[model samples]
Target: MVSAVITAAGLNRRMREDLLSKGMTIEHKLIMDLKGKPVIIRTIENVLESGVKNCVVVLGHYSEEINSVLKDFPDERVKIIYNHDLDCELSETLLNGVKNIEYGLCLCVAADQPTVTYNTMAKLIENAINYENPENIVSILARKETGFLESAEGLGMPFVCHSKLLLNYLPEHKDNLNPILREMISNDVVFYGTPAINELELVNINRYNDYLYIKNKF
Candidate 1:
């Protein structure tokens, strides 16, 4: 069965500071009423609706606050894993989630990306399962041309290997996987990338302005 690993451990430092200066707290950001429901709650709901039977959420910085927001959700389907080292980088969070998963393939998504639709996720899973090489590391979305035009160009791929590929590389390059993964692709490691139905679903909320933009749009 397919599973999903969501990384939500970041400090949300910028957004937290922005709210605090306005006489608010991090809890406001966690359970903030956006489009009538909490932001992360909506994120989790979307994942559940996406057909994934099991989901593991890796929590850090605001673990307590995030958990409080999701307390009403059923424990059977969604499991919350805490990353005690809140100061660690995103790579650690990704690794923590992978270690707990027994599924052959797992989708790693950023928790702050609440706009991801069930359709987009289904497409990713479909491609991964039906593609010529199901074992190849498959990314759900690709960076759009508009994103490049807007000067947001980088390695536009999403997704990474959960087993053979990532596990083999981590021992030598334990710090970051991006460069190593890229090099592996160059050296002919099986990799797959699919276009997203809506590019906005890939937008990750990092700063206060980003949160505001998403709120205004959706």
Candidate 2:
């Protein structure tokens, strides 16, 4: 069974500022409407549908508001965790979620990816489970600028690998997750990229413009 760590904890300064300028009063981007559902909820649903056994959602910055919206979420497979440090970096927030994983294979998801399809997630999970080597990481590369499957920074999020692999390195890691994965690659942890159903499936919401773009696309 694959467990998932959904990182929703971050200071939404850019999105907040962008919404405020338009006189909108959203507490966090995760709770924003994506089609007919909240962005985070849609993300969680897709993860569950993809065959993940369980998932931990790590929340920060508008934790209360995000929690309130997700309080009655119907799936028992989803768990919510809190990172009290509002200014914590992305790696720190992911660390909190990674610690709660109960399965050997862990899937790291960004909560802002509301449009990510279950097919894309399922393909990655299938690859991870069927992989010959336990040490290799399976990931999806969505960013075009990065260009290569293996870059200096290594593969980014929406990746699946052993929880021990992340727990072994993440505690002492800092900043974005890609660098740590890069370090792991240098230490013999090979990463394989799973093709995404669509590049738009991995687009994350950072600002109001992103939200608008996705909403339109959806």
Candidate 3:
């Protein structure tokens, strides 16, 4: 069995401030509309349409609002878990979802990335299964993602790995995955794959402009 883990616990501080300054009143970025549909729904649709059976969504920092959005999706494979402390870091969100999963392999992704497609996710899962080591994480490499150093190795999420591989390195607090990724790099266990996906799907949206660009393109 394989489960898809989605982390959407971010405060969306940048996105919120950007919208407020522009005279908009959006609070929950994950539930914010992405080309008519909510962002979180669009992201999960990608996973479900990709032929993944099980999905686990970790919610925090305004769980009620996100829950309302999730109710629209009637998939039995979709399950929700809550983080009582909104301050829990992103890594914990990843851990929260995977720890409850009984699957040997899981696909991890960020809910904020709406353009991430099912094709990319499916390819990553295949890569993980064929990896030389079960512990090695199969991650996708993006060429056009912004808001980070261009030199950064992999895009933030959409990684495939065994549950045990992550538990061994997961810390209690990690807003970013760099530390864990660095640890894997030092041990030479990270496998990067360039799947045949549209570069737009890998674009990471943190601000209003990003949303507009994605909206206009797709």
Candidate 4:
């Protein structure tokens, strides 16, 4: 059985600022509308449809809002963890999720990536499960510059890795884990890259402009 973790624990400072200007103190970007449903809801729904046996969502910045939105998912299939340190970097959020993963291969995906399809997730899980070398890390590569996609932007360096390897290497550099992960890839860490499904899948909403762009696209 493959496990998946969705990291939703960032301050989303820019989004919060945008909301504050409109007289809102609590605006959860993850729960913001995308198309018709909430962005994070769409993300979690895709994970459930992808055949993953277990799913863990790590919440931080807007925990109450996010948790309230996800209250309908069954506790048995979806679990939530709160990260009090919202200021901590991505590495810390990843580490928190890794500690809860119970499967051999855990996929750490970002909740902001609402465009990620179930088929894309299935492909990643299949590669991780069937890969001959346990040390190999399976990842996805984006093709174009999607406005909201973070990994596909120039020099953004998008890729995914096995939870075991990520957990092992993340602690060495608490501030940033990508550099260390890339180093591992250079040292013969078998990596399987999939063609970008669409530039939209890589979009990560970081600012008000990004949110507007995605809203307009939808």
* RMSD of every prediction: 3.9, 2.2, 3.5, 4.2
Clashing pairs in 2: none
Who is ahead in TM-score, 1 or 4?
Answer: 4
Clashes of each: 0, 0, 0, 4
User: Which of the numbered candidates is closest to the native, going by highest lDDT?
Assistant: 2
Error of 4 at 90 (Å): 0.7
Candidate 1's residue-wise lDDT over 81-199, tens digit each? 98867787676777787777774767667777778777777766766676566665544466644211222224432353445454455445534445665666665655555566664
Per-residue CA lDDT of model 4 for 1-218, tens digit only, reads: 67788888887788888877877665678888888888888888888777778888999877887888888875578899987677788878877887888746776678887777788777766766767765466454435442223242232223445666866777777665556656665666766666557666667777666777777875
Please identify model 1 stretches exceeding 4 Å from their true place. Answer: 20-30, 145-162, 170-177
Each candidate structure's TM-score, on Cα atoms with residue i matched to residue i, is: 0.82, 0.91, 0.89, 0.83
The lDDT per prediction is 0.66, 0.81, 0.76, 0.71
Output the lDDT of residue 59, model 1: 90
How does model 4 fare in lDDT?
A: 0.71
Error of model 1, residue 44, in angstroms:
1.5
Ranking by TM-score: 2, 3, 4, 1
Global fold similarity of model 2 (TM-score): 0.91
lDDT by residue (1-218, candidate 3, tens digit) is 56888888888888888999999888677877777888889999888876666998989887888899897688898998888678878888888888878758888889987787888788777776776776665455445442212233544587777888778777544657766766665666665655446767767778888777887886
Q: For model 2, give the 10-residue run with minimal summed lDDT.
A: 145-154
Instruction: Judging by TM-score, tell me the better candidate of 2 and 3.
Output: 2
